[model samples]
Target: MRKEQRVKKNKEFQEIFKKGTSFANRQFVLYSLKQEEAQPFRIGISVSKKIGNAVCRNRIKRYIRQAFLELREDVQDNHDYLIIARKPAADMDFHEVKSSITHVLKRGKVLKKTSYGKNDRKK
Candidate 1:
């Protein structure tokens, strides 16, 4: 991910928290806000001390980042997203984390609909 495509400023994170809509599952919470100035989506990852120590937190963050990277093209651009990890998230492997992120994003209606089965596609 590029620096330009990350939410790095504290003020930016706060603004997203204050103004954005959020979705959550057992693993993570996703906060999102529209920003026309954002060419591609900007993302921020948060892991609280309650979840674990530094190593554990960093591991969860890495998993979340990898999941987002895989789904970046399917996600809507021009938005800022904040992903806050939950306690259960610390125990999950990469595939679980990816699916959890995908589930949340789908619930949030931020991802383009993908037809995985031939019968599911129209036309």
Candidate 2:
């Protein structure tokens, strides 16, 4: 993701938490707000060092980015989303991370239930 597409700072995160909405599951929290972007939606990923070392955090971030990349079409367009990795996410595998993040997105109404179907079109 580019600099303008990502939510990188603590203040940006907090603002999203404030004005945006959120849904929490066992493995992650999805925070989102509407953006005026013209193209497809963009996402930001955040994983704290408190979870583990740089390696662990990067692993979690990679899994999440991959999950989102795979489901980009099913997600609503033009929304700014933040996927915050929770502690439980560290113990999960790739599919678990995908499921957990998908669950949160579903709960947030950013993604429809049928979005999980394997036959769904790619973005």
Query: Against the true structure, whose TM-score is highest?
Result: 1
TM-score: model 2 vs. ground truth: 0.83
Where's the lowest-lDDT run of ten residues in candidate 1?
A: 114-123
* Whole-model alpha-carbon lDDT for candidate 1: 0.87
In model 1, what is the error at residue 110, expressed in angstroms?
0.3
Return the number of clashes found in candidate 2: 0
- Candidates' C-alpha lDDT: 0.87, 0.80
Candidate 1 residue-wise lDDT at 119: 21
| Model 1 agreement with the true structure over 5-114: per-residue lDDT tens digits | 78999999999999999999999999999997748898999999999999999999889888788778788999999999999998899878988888898888898766
Residue 16, model 1, lDDT: 99
The RMSD (Cα, Å) of candidate 1 is: 3.7
> Which residue pairs come into collision in candidate 2?
none
